[model samples]
Target: MDLEILNQEIDDDEAAYRVRVVRRVHYLTISRKPTAVLDIDTLCRPYLLIPKLPPFPDGNWTKMRISQAANGETEHVLSWDPLDGIHSLWHPRQVDVLSLKRTADHKARVKEVQFDGRILLSKVAIFEWWIPRLQRETEFYERISKDHCLGSGSVAPTFLGHIMEQERCVGFLLEKIDGRHPLLDDHPACEAALRKLHCIGWVHGDVNICNFLVHQSTGHVKLIDFEYAEPFEETKAQLELQKLKDEFSQMTER
Candidate 1:
């Protein structure tokens, strides 16, 4: 859904309450504009499931969707006139997520986010509403479309992006690994995949079964989801390294 925050103001009576011009959300597939206004607090409520949060007044990356970039050429669908449609998210720095209201509509529900209007990114995902951390994550994936994990196995998004409702602040875009199935035990295929990732120094923060996809036809496996991945490491850095090794062993054994 297309989301745009216009202007925001605080209520004189309450510290938590505020009024803002919330642009009507539009499903990218259907070019519709927001026809209503929404009032919310500068501070969003605790709904998004975050184990810990970054220091306030600061912005961190979050995942919003998991999808592969659409390959076939089609008319561009997610564009709007600057004067008519609200184009981007509010700046992430200026706004804080105090409360999030879930929509009844499933489609609208997946694209909604709860954060202040302060922090915003210039790059907006025209197609998807997931991956709040990086707008248009699928678009970003397009940048890495040519990248490969093992020697021959091809990788791509398996599903469209989806929002983690429990963790309202985060979003994810999953890729479809067309014909590959994840290696269950220690196998050469798994080792090659990890070796490839290590050669590039690319880290997969959450290396679990759910985070992987296998192509049945080629035995090619593709990795997806980067909600928690970062080049910079902190306390659990070694653990991440170990996890990669473990995955290698598991696949080799299979």
Candidate 2:
């Protein structure tokens, strides 16, 4: 596909947003499934991508006919018009930018960047709905830090701070780990990490292989993506454990 994510302008009162982009897609060679090329920006610099959704046009109009001076059609750009979209702003200067680990989607975008002389993972939210989860996670780390009953060690990456863009708190930063996702052999360590969280009256609401990071040199397992996590409840904690068990079982079958 000859596609590139270009920034387009959609001004005037008709459209509510000033920025938008359509789409550039590439299909998997084997599956032929299309995926958006949202991470088209270069490495090391910071960017802010917000959701640009405008109000829909009033009518079930499918076809649009543009009129000429003699023809019977209105040549006006109304509130309802054909549009592509906008996202991911990239600057052309040789500036330090974060290495994109994943594209900016509605849920979240992960990137690697240099912050305070340390390489950290930046999980940023592109939409307003997801911003709360990042805020909750920051509070989660704060609570853990104050509690004296739990061990000093943390199974999750160290919480760095909030990622601000356009004067908005979108997400939080975290210590980047040099590790890979847990495999069948790493199941035991993964469970041990999960249990450690439960022992502290917290349930990692989302438990899957992807959320568990196994360290390279130490072989330590760490949990991530705590968007669904919450205070410990007996039933909820057991359900989270069962989710881990089920995932391991499926891996074993594979």
The per-candidate count of clashes, in order, stands at 61, 11
Error at 217, model 2, angstroms = 0.8
lDDT of 2 by residue, 119-209 (tens): 7777765434455676666567667756743232578887656554433345566678889988888878998999998998799888888
User: After superposing candidate 1, which stretches have Cα over 4 Å from the reference?
Assistant: 1-132, 135-175, 179-183, 232-238, 245-254
Clashes of 1: 61
The C-alpha TM-scores of every prediction are: 0.35, 0.59
For lDDT, the strongest prediction is 2
Instruction: Give one digit per residue, the lDDT tens place, for model 1 in 1-254.
Output: 12232212224322111112132322212111131111232223322211122221211222121112345222222333221211222223222222333222213213333233321112222223234434333333433443432234433343223322222323332322344345455245554654445444445567665556566765666665544444434444557556766766676677
Alpha-carbon deviation at 155 in model 2, angstroms = 0.9
What lDDT does the true structure give each of the candidates?
0.35, 0.54
